[model samples]
Target: MHIVITGAGRGIGRTLADRYRAQGHSVTGTARDGSAEIILDVTKPDQQRAMASQLRDTAVDLLICNAGVYLDKSESIVGYPTEMWAQTFASNVTGVFLTVQALLPNLRKAKGKIAILSSQMASHTRAPGGSYIYRSSKAAVLNLGRNLSTDLRHDGIAVGIYHPGWVQTDMGGPAAEITVDQAVDGLMARFKDLSLENTGCFDTFDGQAHAY
Candidate 1:
């Protein structure tokens, strides 16, 4: 399968890229620093268009919208500036949508699957008292993925939203619960299980259905 992953320079995205490549699949990893196979800042329209055109002739078996940010992690109720919210929404919410829109054609060509790396924080049931920007952005993306599933159903495209767990990465911090390897393994399994029949499902890395 030909897999394309955004934000693959580090953390879960990087691990996923390595794991897929080790399994003998064709993987296209994109990073903003031009360090991966493709240089793409998901929030940039020009870069998104360039990526789509570059892969215009290729069929994408899986498109993982993994690029995101958690800008308000340490911000208090009074600390969340308007710019922070805008930046977070651009990276986490709008970025995911743009990637999906840009790759719609490639996905259609292969009847591919889209795995959106949302968070348990996105769920109303898991709501906490912090990270307002991150939480709202994730919730927005969850909504985006669900609606995309409905809109793209006839095209044979499946979209699944997932909470990848509290992974020990630069974003998740070293004290987080899961290791990168563990998260990657579980996420890969979840991705493989995605299908049209179960499109728009919000699930955890370990395969449990998460409350939307």
Candidate 2:
């Protein structure tokens, strides 16, 4: 499988890239810092275009939108700044849209699947206080993924939004609920089993349905 993963410089994205490569699959990992095969800041249209040009209609079996930011992790209700919201949304929301849009042609050529890495925080049922910016951005991505699933259905593409669990990563923190490997193992299964029959699902890494 030829996979394109954004934000593969570190954390879960990095681990996914490594694991996929270990399986002898072709992986095109992108990051803003030039730490991956493609240097793409997904929020930037020029960079997204550059990525498209580099791939040049190459058949992409899977596209994973994983680049995101959690800027309001510990912000107080009165302390959430306007800039933080804008920045977080840019990376977490707009970035996902642009990446999917730019890669649509490649996906179409391969009848591909898009796995959007949203969060459990995106679900209204599990809504807790705090992380306003991060939560809202994730929710937006989940919405985007759902709508994209509808629009792209005619193209034979499947789109699924995922909560990768409270993973032990830089974003999820060391005290989180699950290890990276555990999350990845489950997530890979989810991705592999994703099909048009189950498109637009807002689900967890461990193959469980999540309330949206």
Q: What is every candidate's alpha-carbon RMSD to the true fold?
A: 0.7, 0.7
Across residues 1-212, which tens digit of lDDT does each residue of candidate 2 receive? 99999999998899999999999999999999999999999889999999999999799999999999998888999899999989999999999999999999999999999999999899887776888889899989999999999999999999999999999999889999999999999999999999999999988999999998
Clashing pairs in 1: none
The runs of at least 3 residues in candidate 1 whose Cα sits more than 4 Å from the true structure, single-residue gaps closed, are none
Instruction: Give the number of colliding residue pairs in candidate 1.
Output: 0
Give the clashing pairs for model 2.
none
TM-score of each: 0.99, 0.99
lDDT for each of the candidates?
0.94, 0.94
Model 1 C-alpha RMSD vs. true structure (Å) is 0.7
Candidate 2 TM-score versus the reference? 0.99
